[model samples]
Target: MAKRWTAQDVLDLARLYQPAGVLTAAAVLDVFSPLLAKPMTAEELAGRLSADPRATAILLDALTALKFLSKQDEEYSVPEDVAGLLAEQSADNVLPMVRHLANCLRRWAELPKVIQTGKCAETGLGFRGTDADRADFIGGMNTISRPVATGVIDKIRPLKFRHVVDVGGGAGTWTIALLRAVPRARATLFDLPAVIPIAGQQFAEAGLTDRVNLVGGDYYTDALPEGADLAWLGAICHQNSRRQNRDLFTRVHTALTDDGVIVIRDVIMDSSRTSPEAGALFAVNMLVATEAGGTYTFDEYREDLREAGFDEVILVHQDEFMNSLIRARKT
Candidate 1:
């Protein structure tokens, strides 16, 4: 026997954003960080967060209902399991990524019009805003990508490579993971001019300053640094059109040695392009966030790699988290 879905379940699915909205609001208001100090009544928490007491109380109650916060004796506190991840002062804080998702909610609101017109919103999708917004976006990316980097590195198992070229490596998170796994290996992290300084700081913080070469350049325009045994492209393909990906692969081919390898980690769709529900939903996300980006199938990757002068393309690993690995080698 199994439970049956009902009309109420459909309504519940439609209202899923309610809990998400509550969490996003809390992140924006810096709610959890204050709770780390001590549990306080809604009025005290409102004063600390500069929010309306009544509204704060409602939001805090919603968070408690969602198990993000624990409420007792009219005071609210973050649960121990997630306090480090939500607190702004903690190194493992993911508030930046939560803030980024909050921003995405605005773009998602335009989905109806986008679906009707087959066009993205009027505002272009590339990083747009002040220095602070840019910083938040980059930091958010670092937070989200750190865990993915560790998983990708475990699957990549780059123990044989002496040098790695991390194309479009934001904040050097994946590069740091690779370097840590292959202790004797060094990496060249290439990213935008503005992002290179941030990656420099990350590498320095990881005590890997001497092992990394930070290069600032757009992958679309400038040539990648040469002489690397492995070139890693993590979460880069879904941001470009097929032609752009082919061009990038050609550039990577030119940048590597005769026997060098190219590894791509991204969401890989099934041949039907409908399985892996997350990748399917992420395709819609690309529709709203990028001009020509969308998830691709393994055949498309093989074609792109072969046209770029690579041979023996293979699927190295596939994970439900959308962090699939595809590897190709220059012959």
Candidate 2:
């Protein structure tokens, strides 16, 4: 049977519509930033931010609906539970993520070739040319992966691994999270040359420069650097066809030591394909937004890993949502 999202899940998603939820919290800590300690009229707040009041109000309502706030009259305030995240703003603020989704990466039309041939370039979902897009992608990736990276770090702690390679890592969120969890660990991030500079800046801002090594290379054409006890592919597999997916595994097999491990985190559907409504909808969104990106079932993911050289692929639930971890060991 398929897994169905509860009413709470829907409520949780509705909360993401807030324009200034994270933005408001981020600004709170800056000497020049506005504070959200109390409920303020959306019109007055929007005027100060030079944003549209109507749109801001809609976002506020969405945030309130998600239980992030308690709204009385026309004013809103963050809940005690989430106050810590919103109470302060700094370089570590997650506001970049909220703004990136609202302003940039607004779910553009899918690439034609992905529909026709099912393959995206190193740059998935476009956003490569314009400066605005570039900024959104970099910031969005860092924010989105922050929580996910934290989750992976905790899961892999039991296993004794020294080094990790994050293939197609966007801004090294995984690297930072992993290194944070494992103080003794070091990491390498592999990505396109263009994206590497921005990632390096993130690493510097995070004060993790000494712990990570950034490598610029293509996963399809170039050889994946090896010798790390573990490597990871985060949210990257969905952007390829069957042939291309296998090719990536073959590369990882070659790059790893005899008993190295590769961990994959993505929206893996249940066997019935009817469960996990979120994953199914996500797959459709992938169709609408990209040429080749998708969400695959665990069975589908395992078949690929098995074909590549792995002895076993174990799945771990990261959250109550469709997101899960696939741990494969090269034996």
Candidate 3:
């Protein structure tokens, strides 16, 4: 005999689930950004945002309960991790990626059509839906991607590559990180032409303009610059299908100088397709958004890199998340 789940038990289980908690966390984290460098009471925060003070109080309390904020009496402050993200506009605006889901989720509702057609909805680059959405999309993406930049530097500190290319580098977080880490490093951020002006400004602001290069064009369609010692494919591969990923890598191999290496940071699944809830949910996101995009198992990627002519492929770990750092050396 087995114990049956009661209606209340089922509802409770759903209420206590991870997605509900993560969404709540992301929202709370976003609330901290505009208020960075200044602490405020709930009433003040509510006033600044044109929201209800009582509601803001409740929300701040909830965030405190989640350990993302610290509250005492009526004062509230973001946690160190939350504040770190809020301090940098270009770090990785996780808020945008989260908001990209509002209309984007509608595509999931049409998954039946997508499945039948074998095509996922194209949500276009970064921004979405409205003007405010455009701002949020860019902000959120940069905020969320800052960790990848930090993680790349942390993982590859031992390497002394002089010339690096950040494939699909968008706003240049990876290039900035590598240059800051290795004073001798000179790096290029390869992205669409629309992305250059912004990336140039970012590197300049970081005082890294001298060591940085902005090369704008689609990596798949353009010629990769030769003699680069390292390249990064951070968070970009999960946006394409298997064949597209293969093609991207083949193009990468062609761009590398002999003995060059490619460093990829992405949400890699455990080989058994278990654990790392973020990676699992990100798979759902890719399914809902990309016709070909979905996070893959490391074993799958290793094989792909090998097929693309990398002689040695190594997988590393991120300290804060289950995402894997993949480095493949061209023979």
Candidate 4:
């Protein structure tokens, strides 16, 4: 049923960026980190962050109003619940993803321009700059994927392999999940050179460092590490065009052992490309972020996989977003 919209509803929708901008700006400024230790006056926080005092006070008050922080007297502190997810000292912090969203918000603001030009939005390195932005992006992948990976891997139960290749395995989240799922199996995690160290740190932290070999190279230009019977491409397909995915599948096909299998984890759109609302929205994110990258339909994936010498393509699982699974076997 289509409900009628009112002037206030439209105004509310237009002003939705207010809270998002406040929270993202706070994340970029590390607002919650110091507050985790102790309550502080806005001026103190401003001094610590080298920010403007009045602005800091306004942001802190806004956060308090949002219940993300607690205010007592003239000081502010992060609530324990909020701190657990935003404080730098917390083990379960998701600041990386928050920072990445800040980056995305910047690009999304240029959506109208992208629509007009058929080009990606021009964005500067966010507050912490390029290296930090890249690290946060990779870390954000772990932040988002770590919780769901084990569950996603569960769908491919009875999956036994001596070795699995995790292509573009950002920060080793899926590799860790896969290795844990198959205790007797090992893995070769392949990603860009800058990302290998991050994945290495994660592998070491997971105590699976010795079980996974980290290979650093561009999948587009370099040879994939071979000798694996199974390949896992988690959350990677959406960053590529169909042509690029076919090329990537061809590489995976060559790198696999005979009769090997490949599994892809990404958003699989419906035939109309608009049913899974999240996938459609993500397509717009890709439109602003990549030259030629967006969600794909199952038929599109099947056709691409077949072109890469794979057969018996199947959608093992269907998810409204990135948890969908597609499996294919090398012929």
Candidate 5:
């Protein structure tokens, strides 16, 4: 059954962006890091951040109300639980994800214009600007994915491969997971030139540097590094149109050995495209973020794969979000 809406509920839903705005603003301003060091009055924080004192005070109060900070007398500090996720000093920090979401919040705010023009919204760098935003986006991928990669790879255990090409492999999170799963396997991590260095650093940290080759090139125009028996496309399909996916699949087919397989990890929508609430909302995210990108259904995947010289297409798993798995063999 559908949800029955009430007036109060409707108003509550409409006002959801308030908290998100406050949180994103705080993240963009990097309010948590300084507070993690020591409690300070709003004036001190504002002076350290070079922000408006009055505005900083209001923002700090909002963060305190949201339980992201603790207030004592006139001083404010990050709460322990929030500090673990938001403070840069913490080993398990998700500050990058918070910063990335701040970028998304900017694009999402222009949804009305996108809907009117049928084009992606124009996004601007908030607070810190381009380099930090790019770093945050890539780092956010690792922050969210590294923890779950092992469990997801475990689902397809006993997986053997001599060489695997990790397409658009950001920060080598998935490549590290795959190589760790199959000890003898080697991988070619292909992404944009800007991302290769970051992935190289991660590969070194994972102690898998010798086993992986770092290749930097745009997969859309440049040929993928060939000779791989397996290809892994993690969370990349949703950022393209069906035609683009078919072209990409064709490239993967050519890059693979005769019997090589391709495994895609992304959201797999139902026929309705609405059953998985996350996938549906993510489609809207693509709407504001890309010219022609959205979540796809299994049938769409099967058709695209088949058209690209791939056979035996099957969805190995159906996840509500990016964990869904689809497999196809080069025919």
Candidate 6:
């Protein structure tokens, strides 16, 4: 028999945000950056962070208890492995993603009002703020998407294609991974003007600059570059309504060569739509963050593809992480 949740489980769930809050607070306070050099007592850390000593002590103890930091003789230090990923100055730092999640937490707090009004909160969801924030968000995407790139590529197997068009490809992480897997294949990455520069930098760093053609435009209004044998849309459809996706698919169809393939990487639901718990929860996230974004069933994908004049729509992969793959061909 399967284990069941008890009252204690309910309490645990209720307090689940505590650890996340602690981590977010640490990120906001820039605590990990200071600890990268050496461990410090709460007083010294407070001095470095310009925080209240007593309050800093409390937060340090919480971090130590959570294993994000270790306590040794009153000194608090981030673990060596974690320091590289959490420190703001580290090359591999994911502080931007952490900060973005911290921002998401604030938006999620408005869920009740959003449900009551059937509208998003005043803040709105699209990328807002200066160029720095846009860059950070794109970098955060790179950090989060890197780990899953291999799994997604494995499922899609783009190795056979001579050229691929990565639509709405942020930071070119997937495109880079594809190039690494298929040495002979080249790619075109399309994204917003602001994002293309970042993708160019990433491509340059990966020695993929010569192999990729970077195009910049709003995918909603602009025509995609033509003559690609494969078009990849990673985590794109969930942000649009069925009509919008159909229109986009039609555009993509026009951009591809004869018999070109289209691959979609996203959370694909069963007809019931409830079995994949993550997809269901992500639908809620879409509700809060987008005007019409939500998870779609495989049937919905097939129907949309058919309506857009594509054939052979089929699921290539499905997993609990909501990283499902669907493929279709234009003949």
What are the C-alpha RMSDs, in order, of all predicted structures?
2.9, 6.6, 5.8, 1.0, 0.9, 2.6
Question: Per-residue lDDT for 72 in model 2?
Answer: 82
The CA lDDT at 67 in model 4 is 92
Model 2 TM-score is 0.67
Q: How close is candidate 1 to the true structure, as a TM-score?
A: 0.90
For candidate 2, the 10 contiguous residues with the lowest summed lDDT are 26-35
Q: TM-score for all predictions? A: 0.90, 0.67, 0.71, 0.98, 0.98, 0.90
Q: Write the residue-wise lDDT of candidate 3 on 1-331 in tens digits.
A: 6679899998977676345444433453456865565778989988877778897887777767877678777788776677654434535435555665554555655667766777776545432335545545445567666765665568666877889988988777777877778788788788878678878887888888888778878876788766688988878888887788888899999988889999888888877664477887777767777666887888889889988999678876643233468888998
Candidate 1, backbone clash total:
0
Determine which window of 10 residues in candidate 3 has minimal summed lDDT: 20-29
lDDT of 1 by residue, 1-331 (tens): 5569899998998898888889887887789998998999999999997789999999999999889999999988887777988987788899888877766766777889888987875643423345645677779989878877776778866468999999999888889999999999999999999988889999989999999999999999999999998999988999888999999999999999889999998989899987688898889888887778899999999999999999989999976645899999997
lDDT of 2 by residue, 1-331 (tens): 6569999999987665354444443232221224344567667657766778897677667667756666788876666555644444344555445445433223422335445655432333322235645665666677667766676567755756789888998777777877777789888899988789888997998899998899999997999988888888877887676678889988998988889999887777777764577777667656655566677778888888899988688886644343478899896
Tell me how candidate 5 scores on lDDT. Answer: 0.92
Q: Which ten residues in a row have the lowest lDDT in candidate 5?
A: 123-132
Q: After superposition, how far is residue 264 of candidate 1 from its true place, in Å?
A: 0.3
* Candidate 5 per-residue lDDT over residues 1-331, each given as its tens digit: 7899999999999999889999888888888989999999999999999999999999999989988899999999888889888888898998888888887888998999999999999876567777788789999999999889999988766697899999999899999999988999899999999999999999999899999999999988999999999999999999999999999999999999999999999999999999699999999999999989999999999999999999999889888788999988999
**lDDT (0 to 1) per candidate:** 0.87, 0.69, 0.73, 0.94, 0.92, 0.87
Candidate 1: misplaced stretches above 4 Å? 1-5, 72-74, 122-132
lDDT of 4 at 102: 94
Q: What lDDT, from 0 to 1, does candidate 3 have?
A: 0.73
The segments of candidate 3 whose C-alpha lies over 4 angstroms from its true place after superposition are: 1-6, 12-98, 101-118, 121-135, 318-322
Worst 10 residues of 6 by lDDT: 120-129
List clash counts for every candidate, in order.
0, 3, 13, 0, 0, 0
TM-score for candidate 3: 0.71
TM-score of 6: 0.90
